[model samples]
Target: MNEFSDKLLQWFDHSGRHDLPWQQQQTPYRVWVSEIMLQQTQVKTVIPYYQRFMERFPDLATLAQAEQEDVLAHWSGLGYYARGRNLHKAAQIIQQQHHGVFPTEFDEVVALPGIGRSTAGAILSMALKQRFVILDGNVKRVLSRFLAVAGWPGNKRIENHLWQVAEDFTPHERFDDYTQAIMDLGATLCTRSKPNCQACPVQANCMAFKLNRVKEFPFSKPKKVKPIKQAKLLMLINNQQQVWLEQRPQKGIWGGLWSLPQFETDEALVAALNPSVKTHSEAVSSLVKWKAFRHTFSHYHLDIEPVKLVQEAPADWQGQWHTFTQAESLGLPAPVKLLLSQLESEYVKNG
Candidate 1:
C-alpha cells in the first residue's frame, strides 16, 4: 500500500466504524441501499431506516415485487421522494433485465436509476472488492481539505480534479478497507464543522492543516436566496372524522404520496368548498385553524397554510377520506405527518 493508504488503514484498524449495519453483510444490494440512504443524510439518522427497510424488503426480488405505494410508505418521512421512486424503478430493472441480480459491470451499475458514478463506485468497491474510486460528499471534503483544493467541489472542474486525485491515491490491494477508511476518516475526524484535525492520521501531509486553512478548503457553494412559494392545504373532515387526501402527481414535490388537497390561495380553496362547485352539495362548516408553517427544500421553501373544514359528508371533495390513524400509515411528507399528528392529538383530547 502507498503511504496514504497505509496510514489510513492503520488508523482505521482502531478508529473507523466497523459495525455499520451494511458493513456486517457487505452485499451489493445492502451496500447500494445504505449508500443511497447516506446521500445527503447522516449516519445516525440512516441506521434505523436501513434496518427497517431491510426488514421490509429483504432482497432485490422482494423490493421489485413491492408496490410503489408500499415502497414509498417505507421511505415516507425520509425525504427526497425522488430517491425512493428511483430506487423502486431500479429494482424492477435489475429483476427484469439482469435476472434479479445486481449489475456487476461499472457502466451497468451507473446506468441504474439513482446510482451515480460515485455511488456505483462505492457499491462495487465494498461488495465486489473492485478498485473503483469514489467521491461522495465525505470523500470530497476529506480530499479537498487534504490537498487544499480550491473552489467549491460542486464545480465540474474542481470535481474532476478531485476524481483524479482519488484515482492516484487508490491502492490495488485492500481497496475495500481503503474505501471505508477514507469515508470513515471524513465522517469522523474530518467533519464539516469543528473537525477533529488533531486526531487525524493523515494530518502530517494535509495541505489545509499545514497552511492553517482547514476551514477554507472544501469551499461552500455560492449562495443564492432560495425562492419562497406559498400554498393552502385543505384539511376537509367529515362527521366520521376522516380527512380528505389526494395523491400527488407521479412527478414533482411529494410525488406519489398522499397529501391534503392543495390550492394556490384561500379564494381558490373557498371556491372549491362551495356547494355550487360540488358534484353533490353537502353542508359544511369552518372549524378551528391549525398553526401554519414552512417546509424548506434544497432549492426552495414552501409556505404551507392549512385550513380545516368540517362537513356532514364530503361528497363534493374529489379524493378519499382517511382517518388520522390510516393517514399515518400512508406515504405522507414529514411536515404533513406532523400536522396530522397534531390533529390526531386534538381529536383524542376532544373525545
Candidate 2:
C-alpha cells in the first residue's frame, strides 16, 4: 500500500465508523439518500430522520413516484427543504431520463439541480467508489488545517487549490473506506471548536499540528450579521384538540413545509384578513397568547410569537387537526415543533 493509503487505512480501522445506519447496507440508493440528508446537517440528527425517510420511500422508483408534498413532508423537520426537493427532482430524472439508476458519472450527478461538485463527488466516491474527492465543511476544515491553507476557503481560487489537495490525498484502493475516513477524521478528531488532538491520528505529520495553529489555520472570513426577521405564528386550536396549520409556499425559507400561520405582525394579520377569514365571525373567536419565540436561520433570525386561538373557524380553510398524538403526521419545521413541544408541556401541566 502507498504511504497515505496505509496511514489512512490504519487510522480508519481503529477510528472510523463501521456502524452508521447507511453503512450497514451500503447500496447506491441507501448511500445517496444518507449523503443528501447529511448536507449542512449532523449525523446525530440525521439518523432517525434517515431511518424514517427510507422507510417512507425505500428506493429510487418510490422517491420518483412520490408526490411533492409527501417528499416535503418526509423532509419536514430537516432544514434545507431544497435538498429534499432536488432529491425528488433528481430521482424523477434518473427514473425517467436514466432508467431508475443513480448515474455513476461525476458530471451527470453535478448537473442535477441543487447538487454541487462536492455533493456529486460524495455520491460518486462513497456510493460507487469511483474515486472522486469531496470538499464538504468537515473535509475543508480538516484539509485547511492539515496543509495550513491560508485565505478564505470559500473563494474560488482557494477552493480549487483545496480541491487539488483533496484529489492528491485520496487513495485508489478501498475507495469507500478512504472516502469515509477523511470525513470521520474531521468530524471526530479535527473538530471546529476544540479538537481531540491527543487522539488525532494525523497529528504526527499535520502541518497545523507542528505549528500549534490548527484553529487559526482554517482562517475566518468576515461575516455580515444575520439580519433579524420577525413573524407572528398562530396556534389555532379547537376544543376538539386540532390545531390550524398552513402549508408554506413552495420556495424560500421553509418552503413546502407545514407551519402555523406566520404573518409579519399581529396587526397585519388582522387587517389583511383572507376573504375566507373575513366571511366568518366565528373564525375570529378568541386569541390566546402563548410565549413568543425567536428562531435564527443561517441568513436571518425570526422573532416568532406563537399565539393560541380557540373557537370554530371556517371549515373551508385547507387544514385539519391531528390531535397531539398524531401531530407527527403533519410535517413541521423546527420552530413549529418547538412551539408544539411548549404547548404539549403546558397541556400536561394543566392536566
Give residue 278's lDDT in candidate 1 (0 to 100): 50
lDDT of each: 0.89, 0.80
Clashing pairs in 2: none
Error of 1 at 105 (Å): 0.2
- Output the worst ten-in-a-row residue range by lDDT, candidate 1: 279-288
Give lDDT tens digits, candidate 1, residues 1-351: 788889999999999999999998779999999999999789999899889999999999999999999999989889998998999999999999999999999999999999999999999999988889899999999999999999999999999999999998989998999999999998999999989999999999999999999999899999999999998887778889898888899988999999988888766666666646653212223434567789999989999988888764346555688988889789998988888888888889999
User: Which prediction has the highest TM-score against the true structure?
Assistant: 1
What is the per-residue lDDT of model 2 for residues 1-351, given as tens digits with 9 covering 90 to 100? 456556767999987888999997677789888888888888999999999998999899999999988888788778888899999998999998888978888888888877889888887888787878888998889889888898888888889999998888887777678889888888888898998888887787888889988879687776778888888787777787677777778778887777877778665555344543544444444446667667888788888877676645555666666567667666679888878887877777987
